[model samples]
Target: MTTYIPSLTIPSVVLQHSAASVLLPIALGTAVGFGTRPSKTQKTYLALKQPPLRPPPWVFGPVWTVLYGVMGYASHRIATIGLRSSASPAIVETAQNSLTLYTVQLGLNLAWMPLFFVAKRPSEASIDIVTLIGMNAYLAYLWSSIDEVAAWCQVPYLGWLGFATYLCVGAGYLNGWDLHDKEVKEE
Candidate 1:
């Protein structure tokens, strides 16, 4: 006889209720982006170190919406492409490498919004952005290996990473993410 133990996970039936893998990550990612977004005050809060020069509050949602959509689709393509192709073993390693980079970048993408927007800690977000920069570079490198178009699709994402990095650094300079008692908690 053996003792039985329960698992601490959702059943497969609940874990995947649809084919919209892209939706789950995308919407949540966008929401994280949304949650971190600043109003005039937060941007003003950011003005302590340098020129605010922040975009209008209205622009954030729409721009992030489009970017999130593209990122999700690109990620879907990256995750799904090989399943449809029965390639030889020689190319499998290459595919795996590209996939690895793509996945890492995706994780970094998911991380950034929460750190910047929700936590309101640009310093932590700055740290995350460095990872984003590295991950984006790897993803781009992997993209070049697969196809020019796939690589090209990631270009805007890279630009976004760069812009976001600049914003994070500037914001951190102004607000000091380590400000207040918030630093006691893990961001």
Candidate 2:
């Protein structure tokens, strides 16, 4: 009988240098936000209308983990891109503009957790959701302005936020829209 030897296969290191910088903040946001507050109900609700193409609940964790990693590193890539670029002034200006928008949106993305989970205010969360949606929209526009590869990374996030907006709107209405409004007016 002939003995067979098996070879181990190692995956190629396709990730670029900028991957860590871009994805770090995203991962930080996730860990900080989730660790600060647990939202069992919210997670379930968010998954309610999840598209058929979307991954399962368990899949979200790992997928987002990797995505955020890429995002953080990619952000660093963009930040340094123009700094070291030998390109024209116009090109550098474009890179600067893109980075500004990306950074701003990332802040807004990070803000959603506090508004939604810690505050436990669906109405406030709904407003934040709208704001985050707009932020993502601007980020998308900025991505298109800078590089397709970078902008494409946000597609899954935007889609989740889209469904999340609807859930927040529904929950906001369900929780109490006018109660807080009346109190605000009284004050």
Across residues 70-126, which tens digit of lDDT does each residue of candidate 1 receive?
655554454444323575454445545555555556666777666655555677778
Model 2 / residue 114 / CA error / Å: 1.7
For candidate 2, report its TM-score. 0.65
Q: Which one wins on TM-score?
A: 1
- Candidate 2 per-residue lDDT, tens place, 28-82, comes to 6777657754455345334333323544446545655665665655555455554
Point to the candidate with the largest lDDT: 1
**Candidate 2, residue 124: how far the Cα is off, in Å:** 2.2
Per-model TM-score versus the true fold: 0.68, 0.65
Report the Cα RMSD per candidate: 7.7, 14.8
